[model samples]
Target: MEWIFLLLVGLAAGTLGSLVGLGGGIIVVPALIYLGSFIPGLDNLSPQVAVGTSLIVVIFTGLSSTLAYMKHKTVDYKSGLIFFIGSGPGSIIGAFINKSMNVQSFSLYFGLFMILVSIILMVRGKIKPLKLRSKYNYMRNYTNENGLETSYGFNPFVALPISFVVGLISGLFGVGGGSLMVPAMILLFMFPPHIAVATSMFMIFLSAVTSSVAHISLGNVHWLLTLVLVPGAWFGGAFGAKINTRLKGHTVITLLRVILIIIGLRLIYQGLT
Candidate 1:
């Protein structure tokens, strides 16, 4: 029964995460922590273990999503690589910080972060993309399925620092860091939504690798739990990416926002108790 629940959690996490470029860790971490309190074997779960296990699952989800998105030619590999330069190191730092947090504190902070991410999703569409004029910008054009080309660009100098912060949050919270990166890519970099999401998954894959290494070295991972979650997450990531190509996504986004808020409140209540 626990195994089945874990599998469902992984599937749900991966689908929602990949669909919105959030990297599924947001769902995995909290679910682990919640289940740990009641489930027999998981009763010993700590924040570190939960986070580490989630990051491992995130690696699979990100990779699966990236591959699926690559088939659509939406991933911006160059930008993803540049973002990794900063995120890789930042992930290490964040992993180290995660070691110091206790359950109550981690729950509180993660809950707050989830609420913030939900708010970001709510307003993301309303904000117009910013136009920045700079010689350092890396410009590119994306041709959609309908044969319309859209141009976008971003300055690496600006993007690197932001990605670093995103990585830090990712490692600390066991999230894929797409919640922050997607918005930044769309607003600051003028990336098309599909391109930003695809590129964000690529970066998430890289950052998760670094973060997972750090967690492993720290002895924070729950290997058994991670193994059980991977297959579901992997398939769900691919499924979500395929859906992204055909679905309007707005309805899903709305449902996701409500779920996040509910989860955030529940986590906050748990923390307070």
Candidate 2:
């Protein structure tokens, strides 16, 4: 019965996670913790265990999301490849650090990180199109029959380094990495917001798989939970891809920022109390 319950939770988490580009961890971690608190037998595992387990399930979530994005050519392969170059090593280092930390410490730092991200998002909201109109103005111009028109390029050079940091955060928190990566691609890399989300999903797919493998070798994965979660993740990802086609770039960014703020506040409350 308890296993059945966990499977249901996984399904719901995956659906919401993919829809919002949150990755399953944001939803799955809280769901597991809630269930653990209420269920007697399963409560024996520590909070860290719950977090680790949720992280493992997110591997499926990322892959499923990535596949959906790939069908539309939303993923920018060059950017993903460069970001992977830096992030792959960084993930291992972050995981090692996670293994050594205490649960309370982890919670504290995680909350702090969430808050920091929230602040950045808020600030990003206020920054007008200044940069976009400046040296990176190439996004606003292009060549056509009339001589020139605005063209948006998924330039890799601008997207890579920031994406690496986003990946590092993924390793640290066991997230899909899309939360950070998508925003960076939009704000820093100058990709269209929908494209950024799709590309981030792809990057998350690779990074999550790499991190999950590392977690497995270190004895941090929960296979039972993962099996329960993947199906939902797949379907949710496909749905999200469908939704992305209709949303305008700025609207997606705005929605994502709002969700991030809400999640950040929740994490802060959890950590403080």
Candidate 3:
């Protein structure tokens, strides 16, 4: 029963995470902690272990989503790589910080972060993309299936620092960091929504690798649980990406915003209690 529950959670997390480029860790980490409170086998689960295990699952989710998105030709590989240059070191720092957090504190901070993510989602659409003129900016163009061409660009100096902060949040919380990165890409860098999501997933895969290594070195992962979650996450990620190609994602984002708010409030209450 517990295995089944976990499998379903993994599937849901991966699907939603992949669909939005948020990386499934946002769902997985919270679910693990919630399950730990009452489930017999998971009663001893710690925040660090939950985070570590979630990061492992995120690796598979990111990989699966990135592969699926590749078929759509939406991922910006060069930008993803450049973002990783900053995110990689930031992830290492976040992982080290995670090692020192207690459950209540971790819950409190993570809940706050979730609220922030929800707020970002709420306001993301209202903020128009900015056009900046910089010699250091790298510009690219994309054409949709409808043959409509759009262009976007960003300065590396600005993008690298933003990605670093995204990576730090991801490492600290075992999330994919897409909630932050996707918004930054869209609002600050003028990336199309689809491109931002696809690129974010690509970066998530890279950052997850580095963060997972740090957690592994700290002995924070639950090997059995991680193994159980991987298969579901992998399949769900593929499924979500397929859906993404067909959907505009507004409805899903709306639902996700509400869900995050509820979860954030619940976690915050738990932490306070």
Model-by-model lDDT, in order?
A: 0.93, 0.63, 0.92
Clashes per model (N, Cα, C within 3 A) = 0, 1, 0
User: Candidate 3 has what TM-score?
Assistant: 0.97
Residue-wise C-alpha lDDT for candidate 1, range 1-273, written one tens digit per residue: 989999999998889889999999999998999899788877989999999999999999999999999999999999899999989999999999999999988988999999999999999888689999899999999899999999999999999999999999989999999999999999999999999999999999999999999999999999999988999999999999998888869898999899889999988887889
User: Candidates ranked by TM-score, best first?
Assistant: 1, 3, 2
**Which stretches of model 2 miss by more than 4 angstroms?**
1-5, 116-160, 248-273
Q: What value does the lDDT take at residue 250 in candidate 1? A: 89
Candidate 1 stretches with Cα past 4 Å from truth are none
Better of 2 and 3 by lDDT: 3
**Number of the predicted model whose TM-score against the real structure is largest:** 1
Best-to-worst order by lDDT is 1, 3, 2
Q: What local lDDT score does residue 9 receive in model 2, on the 0 to 100 scale?
A: 67
lDDT of 2 by residue, 1-273 (tens): 766777766765565556556676766665565576676766655545655677677767667777777776666676666677766776666666677766556666676665665565556545332243345332422233345443454344555566667666767777766667666656654665556666666677777777666666778765666677666666766766666665534565456456656666666676667
In model 1, which range of ten residues has the least summed lDDT?
243-252
lDDT for predicted candidate 2 compared with the true structure: 0.63
- The candidate 2 region of ten consecutive residues with least summed lDDT is 136-145
